[model samples]
Target: MEKSNQLFNQEQQIIHRLLLNAPFIPSVGLLTGQVGIALAFYTYYRHTECAVYGDFAGELLDNALESLDKSIDIAFSNGLTGIGWGIEYLILKGFVDGCGVEICENIDQKIMESDPRRISDLSLEQGLEGLIHYVLIHISASIKQNVRLPFDSLYLKDLYTVVKQACQEDIPDSFRSLAEIYMDFIEKQEPIDYPLHLFSFIDIVHLDTDKLTDYPLGIKDGLAGLLLKEITNE
Candidate 1:
């Protein structure tokens, strides 16, 4: 994980420019990528104790929403469920709360309003199912992260039902089956099964082992693998 200051500086400049207008526009991809990178760097620090990546990840997340002063809400240019993944990370990592939590909650509401059947693109990153996959990932994350019985025993369960119905009839029941497992884990009804179901979660998110480090965000690296990494890190 060692690197020259030049590489750090280059990454800084690139992310900085992309982040400047992030909060003001509907840049879900960009904003989510920023958060994913931060999580990767932070997780790298957590796993390997690398201060450089940790600090860089922190700074990246800290300055991510600079335009919040201009806009109160995180605007979405189109229908997307993965949009809230960044805010969820911010809260999970203790980066933002108060107004940040409010903003994050608003993002959830927007996601609920999104068309469960409308996947905007075919890329593994932004497709309807990909977004839904992430929604499942993040929803599972939220369930695991909660202190008060994990959002009252179910996080994003409603959204799961909405999108699940839109899927093909032959979709595997691992995720939703795990949904019950999730509830049980949160409710202490079947807590032992939660850990068992987690390994199966890889199927739900469609993780590609080879692409785990391909980038800082989107499907392969940030939003998916790193996200799962954080969950397992617990």
Candidate 2:
């Protein structure tokens, strides 16, 4: 168990460093697309290696999956929205798909059985609010890090303006209010409490269990085909 934990932590650190230092190409979608592909391949290799080796392999693979799932939860809880959200989703889905549904499902069920808090019953509205807070936190971090903004230069400003205008036109005030808070944080360079603030808005639970269970049929074959073609051409 100690060895497994060490391995899991090391892998996570490597992934996080890559995600943080990846060059910004001025397109969130493109950046995340590249990241998603790389992450999927890395995850597939790790999962397959463990699956091929029987003995204590199942336990090790389960640890790996659980660690990955927890990382995804932390990302979402920290306001990982937009392209980052999609990338993490693809990484999780692709890894599970590569691992085979039966194995993945058995692990997931075991996780849920052990931790009741692993699933949530939050409303969509509440979830959206959590997402908003997360976005705001990331925007503030971007400003501090001086990384190129993921969206258009004026995207955040434009969103604030549009929301304010909507308020004047008698549209719902909730979103506009949230927008105002985000704008303030961006302008003031205030630090966000991140995962702490995240928990205030949403419970710490995996919300998309059913989606995770499905495994995007044939994805493993698609990945295998690409690998085989590369080998043949090489």
Candidate 3:
């Protein structure tokens, strides 16, 4: 448990640094990737039948999911949609199915049981990644399209490269294939849809303030709060 917390803290610091250097658009995408990592850990810890890693994954997953959902809500409130959803779907699919992890066989059906609005929230969280991909495909879209953006072509390229590396390292071996598929989709200019098939496996739990208070600084009120505030301006 101590070691896990240490590792989580280390990862949080790394992410914080990345966010500081990243442009607003890609920073959101990077945050979405972090959300995916949280969801992946949550799914692996909560839904996996095997108890090989014990309860640590579940605890970490719970906190991570809470942060992720909050981030998604912030994105939705800001009027973003579509691509975020697709990115999240791909991320979840890679984690739950493509990674070669054996999650509950009935996961798809379970997702269908969730509120449709929740599905929308997950999708909207991928806004940054989706927007980036959209620009990449349009070719004629100028960086000046969003005059407020501070990113240049080179910066965007670097952001994508970092995202790819982060996903590869964060996702387990079982899900690496799924991550690769997502990359291929981006490379080939293929359209991405919400991966409805893998939705059932994810169980987004609500965390109360009281519960969050028990978490580490990063999970409790650091990363999630900072990112949400930056994106939402409230």
Candidate 4:
């Protein structure tokens, strides 16, 4: 066996051992939702330019991404629709270390401000899944529009810039007016009645955060955003 193969085998063995004993280990970052640690490993993968290091770091990157993806999949399967609170919990537990009180509070504020449930004072969010199914039939009938409501908490707040840009030309002014009305109805501090345009709402809530901030976290917004983009295209 050559030196490189021997080293590979050794490292692989160590990884297997760590994975088997992961629950007992204190620093298995993915298990604990410490994505910063995962990102650190990813940096090593991307920046490893050493001739001697070769494919080792690349392999590690694959594992890191796969591990993170699996964790996401497992969480999704077990009803992890939104990761906002989880991230905040990380911040509080000092897992998101170094971001102090002010930054954490800002992050917390952003999360609460954007959620439709928060903005609507829990009114709009109630029966959201059932509401989607019920209204899909009628809206599709009256306007012939096939509505794909944004994912849980994927709000217009998340896609604020998208809305603002879409409303810039105001071909009929309805789009812009609709945007304003929705904002006014769902005022963060004091929500009024449920907006007539309910599907315009989202759980992840419409994604104005596309440019405003980083609420949906990474590609956390996922493919549901494709529908949002397509609608904005009109």
Candidate 4 lDDT, tens digit per residue, 1-234? Answer: 555534334223333332233223222222222232222223223344443222432333234333333233212111121122223233333334423233223322333243333221111122122222222222222222232222223443444434444445533343444454444533452232222331232223343422422332211231222222333444
- Weakest lDDT window of 10 consecutive positions for candidate 2: 215-224
**Residue 92 in candidate 2, Cα distance off native in Å:** 21
lDDT (0-100) at residue 95 of candidate 3? 36
Candidate 4: stretches off by over 4 Å: 1-54, 68-154, 158-234
* TM of each candidate vs. truth: 0.45, 0.29, 0.23, 0.20
Give the CA lDDT, 0 to 100, for residue 202 in model 4.
Answer: 26
Give residue 227's lDDT in candidate 4 (0 to 100): 27
Look at candidate 1 and tell me the lDDT of residue 135: 45
True-vs-predicted CA distance for residue 73, candidate 2, Å: 17
The 0-to-1 C-alpha lDDT of every candidate, in the order given, reads 0.42, 0.34, 0.33, 0.30
Better of 1 and 3 by TM-score: 1
Residues 53-162, model 3: lDDT tens digits: 22433333334333332233323212122223323343344432221011211221222233322222113133233333322322212221322222243444444454
- RMSD in order of candidates: 9.0, 18.4, 17.7, 18.5
Q: Give per-residue lDDT, candidate 1, residue 208.
A: 46
* Poorest lDDT segment (10 consecutive residues) of candidate 4: 73-82
Clashing pairs in 1: 119-128
Per-residue lDDT of 185 in model 4: 32
